[model samples]
Target chain A: MASLKDRIGVIKLNQKVAKDIYKMVLQFDDMPDDIKGGQFAHVKLNDKSHILRRPFCICDYDISAKTITLCYAVVGDGTKVLSSYEVGEKLQVMLPLGNGFTPDKNVKKVVLLGGGMGSAVLPAIPTSNPELEYYTYLGFANKEKVVLEEEMAKVSKQLTVATDDGSYGKKGFVTNILAEDMAKLKPDVVFCCGPEVMYKALKKALEPFDVPIIVSLEARMGCGIGACLVCNCKVKRAGEEETYVRVCVEGPVMKLSEVVL
Target chain B: MSNLKVNIAGVEFKNPIITASGTFGFGREYDRFYNIEELGGICTKGLTIKPKLGNPPPRIAESYGGMLNSVGLQNPGVDHYLQKDDLYLAKRDVVVIANVAGSTLDDYIAIAEKINGSKSDMVELNISCPNVKEGGMAFGVLPQSVERVTSAVKKACPNKPIITKLSPNVACIADNAKAAEAGGADAISLINTLSGMAVNYKTRKPILFNNNGGMSGPCVKPVALKMVWDCYNAVKIPIIGLGGITSYTDVLEFMICGARAVQVGTYNFNNPYGARDIAKDLATYVEENNMDINDLVGTLILNK
Candidate 1:
């Protein structure tokens, strides 16, 4: 493996575009070059106490602007420290850490589903796909927790939202809405990134439908590399009941059928 | 500046800071963050006669204040390490201590003999890995076996310093340290990991595939420090202390209680730059106190 620490350069902390979430973007001259959709970057907050790096999936890769956008929730100490960075301060980041999704030629129609912070990586991919028809499905706990609705709607050919509290869009879960639109959308492939329960529920719903499916899994990660096997999830292997693979290295993305879910 | 430098047998280390084997992984990954050469030394990943693929998935699990691991001593063999010509570490300047494990006494002897002729600064006999099915902690638990392996490696690698790493899984760490000393070991490193298990309440099964694993991290510091103190009082040989040392205070506790040098393990997983931060923080502590680092060693007074 290439130890390309140089791939990440000094990215100035732009500003706190959202509460508890800083909207820092990479500005390296060489960055945004060849940065494909669905990739991730390792962000390091300049703090002595929180030493390990944190990984974030790419929200938007602007090759022209030489920037990548990432919106993360400040759930722990690392992100809490990260939120302290101001517009001029610099931080070290390792970009494009994992393998991202590539739109298949035969699979023209795609549906993107995301929930909570999982909604971060959705806008960058299917919304930007020019050749294929793509629809975005999002789920949130309530209207107050809903995010990126306008941005997603701007890019997707059709947008559907579901809130558990029945506060916005449709009542009940996102998968329920997908079940209603399964016939008209006729998506060739389904891509999902969300909470474990959300993914687990979606997995069961999509099981009967025959199509290529890809999912991004989340786990507690120390190093955004394969060396430390801290970030692993159960994956089914041929002849074997189940095996754990690193979510950081083997994937953030896996085929619906290939993964045990 | 405080004298943080320490000596094992005749070999010298610039400071009491040493990176634990397996956790540091041959010193390749962490170098990406800081200059590894600044630390005292590095105990490489546990190497066997032949390369090991390690255990299956679910090798690590987190606990309240610590973590458990069943890495199963995965590493390329002794010959492979020698063949690399230290290419991965060419640019760095640090003492490279080779950690060796074997199924039998002969296995330890063979690996020790090979490391004696290699660039490794010292030979750390792995008599205490709880994750492995056999031949690791098994060799360290029984006093007779500890003596047997220590003596075997000492006899095979007379030129190199042989530090027998002790297992906390035993009934008494002090007795194990004494056995290693009597067996002719130059030094001893303690508390490999207390045997532990974390049950998934819903599944009602153990978290690790091995059913049990070695616990390391902040959770076990007190247990490790107590073991180090006990072993330090029991044996004349230098004690290399390790167990969930994540801060300057933890390092100081190890030193004051008679650890010649300290190793940072599980904390590496929590923080990639853990070693560097601890080194800096320890140095600052040493300077702020207006005392030498050696002054901290074995200063623990056992109440009569």
Candidate 2:
């Protein structure tokens, strides 16, 4: 029942964090308490050409400063326009959107797996709940694409960085390390956000572990809410056939088993 | 507070702001954001005889100042609306406008007849959905076809007021509006999303699953306003204007150009409380200007 709030957030900082990726810090007057890991902010671009607001996962939040950090890559015209924005420029943003990851109090150990920019949501898990033990596996296309190692390390007890081209940290996919270390880590719950292919592979690798896995999905959203019915993915419900649900509302975060992908 | 009320074809609305069909769903989705009753009316999604799964994935594609959608009339059908949705909508304080679409003439008649005596305040015939492969935009393009479909729906739902939603994809939108008015339409609402397509250079294909989709958003406002003005001068029936209406100023512009009421379409996606915000701002504008809401309708000055 949480409604979306449109607030003018000033760009406190907008700088390149890694190759093609720029980290932006938006300072708002009143920050809602419900914003959690995996929830995104629908940011409106100042340029008239980009009509739809682009969705970016919340990378971190500074409660005292009332600021939320977003790490996004310049993939298209919208993101390209966002990158050129100067500090102190006001941008329209709809926030605390979609359901975030549900951190179980009973679960003691957690493993957060992120592929590429999917790592954006990792720090929020630990920052929000300091009591819970956290381990993170971050995957990047190469060494140049890696970002936010220090911030993620501050929240996570242990962090592993992997690259596809053997250019940085461990030379393989993040799932490669998770598959080999799952028995030893003994994580009670696993959360992931990444490309569809990575999700399929991770789901298969964790099939034998008997651990519950949740995934954050990405889609080309029209409304970024349930109204447009554009960001739909087929999901399977208990005792019901597979049906399409909006990723923007039903979740950008959902159980891996519930989703067909 | 200023009086923002307006009557369209005998059905009175609290304000001139109605949520466009397809964009507002059944009013449940946006109810969490704002009170549904605060707006003039709620236009339900286009209903068909049977539940439709709609098009495949990539149903939406972003365009300049707008977006394109190929969602082909996906709904739970009219029976579901009558049994379950009616009570939910009836208990609400707002006017409910049932927007119905069909694949054939019989399909339109069947749906209209079923909704005749229901809780619906009015029925908006959507013969102009461009995404559907069959019977949708085809029935809306030509004046003869528009008249035929509108008259048939009128016969089926004699008790309920009928608004024929016109498409802008045709040669002349004003001609189609005249056709609907000639066919005994109680009112006319237009223009539906302009038929458009977006391309992916790398994929060498269209972005939407249906290849071509209907475009709606801020970019379509001028085109929609011009058409509404043309239709207003052409027909005597009330015209409910829509298409890329995002702000209260746009609402006033449409009214000045001769729209009795305006429906907020793509803006609902941009801001969930868009219509509510516009409704509030409109009242402020009316009070500040010390002008009656009705005085603004059809007050556009023609350049000599």
Candidate 3:
């Protein structure tokens, strides 16, 4: 269990990377050198109206520069406020929160699937484990929403992009493409992070493969620590009744089979 | 350091800043950010006779200057807490206050009996949880029920002091505080979250899974302060004030109004190190003012 800390991070960059999505790079003097793949940063906004801090997955971290990059969509009041922050401004954030993805050491082949803003967390996978053979599948609503292709490509052995509208890449759902490539890819493990709808579809699409799947779930959180119990997800344990686990603690990342989703 | 020590009932706290129940989970999670022993006391999450899974997804909704929570009392039962968390909490140099909730009188008694003479320094009777369907807010709304529940728990736990936590949703908050004191409660803590609800306009439905939730944060400070003041004047027993407490200034305000100690609730979520920082700031404030921390309690003057 990595210890969580509140650090005042200086925003080095805050700019739009895609439609309605902006990327922020923050520099912290005392951040942990290594943050897990699926871990997120709980960012506090300047506006007092929004009491709860917004949780965003860590897109990447630069240890040498002591910086962490976060990519988020301007969906709510918190993000809207965050988008307006300029460089040199101090942002308070709790870092390296929740249980991140655990890549199996014995597994040789890996598949990473991300959708929309979910693509933000995929880039860290290959960066953390450079030895593993990787395949990336990214899904977007349209071509305009697509992002992080060049960054993910630098790390993945094979990268595939899918859009709902046939504007860029394949014309269909990313899970459909995942289904087609499962046999050929024969990935030993699969990691996914996206919308709830995508997880529901991927749960069925990857059911036949018998490969272990890890997923990073997102929820509106009060305290990004385990205390508040606001961000809960149903998890079914072996030989026990279904129970709720805090997404901020037990996971943002969990085994597909363990989660009730 | 200006005599930060304060005694609640027979239990002694190093300072007047205790982490509120439900916000601090057995002192482990927040310990990662700061030392739990830095505070005066820690109130564990609302424990029950049986383990609770709590409400479904979307248990929280952010409101103006506050947030609503429908996380009903989610805990691994009193037995589990004693078995797993008691030893760990006991080893720490802080007072451990067990905050217990139940659906029925027997449920309260069962948990009280389990915690009696345990490692817990005190028992905080949480009869004001609004998220549960039965028992919680019911026992807290009326003065008679509040007295009944407080007396029952007081009888059950003979060794530990019982602090009845009163709800603010009632018609008269001071009457409930006096009721707890009349029922043999050792002390009183007031202004548990006020019952409220939030809606998503697009869906035209409540945001919380439980439909209604308890609202706590800076938004409830004035309401909490008044309740604490009213309760202080109503009862001779000490009052632990809470409701949207965020900083040392809020703590001072609560103390001056009549709270012997203040509990940091929703502010814990906003900043994990809030209690620690406030404690330090309070010490500095006391030193700068050239007064002991005790002198600040119940110092508010009524305007003629």
Q: Ranking under TM-score, best-scoring first?
A: 3, 2, 1
For A122-191, candidate 2 gives per-residue lDDT tens digits of 7777767778888889999999999988887887878999999989999998997898999999999998
Residue-level lDDT of model 3, residues B1-304, one tens digit each, is: 4578899897889899999999988888888888889999999999999999898978999999999999988888999999988889999999999999999999999999999958989999999998899999999999999999999999999999999999898999899988999999999998889889999988999999889999999999999998898888899999999998888999989999999998998888888798999999988888788777888888899999
Ranking by DockQ: 3, 2, 1
Q: Rank the candidates by lDDT, best first.
A: 3, 2, 1
Which regions of candidate 2 deviate over 4 angstroms? A1-4, B1-3
Please state the Cα-based DockQ of model 3 relative to the true two-chain complex.
0.77
Residues A1-261, candidate 1: write the lDDT tens digits.
344443444455555544454556667666746565677887766643454567888888677777777778887656776776665566667767777778777988889998777888787785356577778999988886677788788778899888888988888899778867887778988888888787778877877677677888766565666555556666886687666666777888876566765
Better of 2 and 3 by DockQ: 3
* Residue-wise C-alpha lDDT for candidate 1, range B1-304, written one tens digit per residue: 6567788888788877899887877776677667788898888889999877677656776665677777777776889888883556544577778899998888888888888888777889999988788798789999999999999899999888999999888888888899999999999998788899978887899877778888888778899899999998898989899998988899889988999899997777655677878988888878787778877789998799
Q: Which stretches of candidate 3 lie over 4 Å from their true place?
A: A1-3
Model 2, A23: alpha-carbon shift in Å? Answer: 1.3
lDDT of 3: 0.90
**Could you tell me every candidate's TM-score relative to the true structure?**
0.74, 0.94, 0.98
| Model 2 Cα shift for residue B283 (angstroms) | 2.6
What are the Cα lDDT values of the candidates? Answer: 0.78, 0.89, 0.90
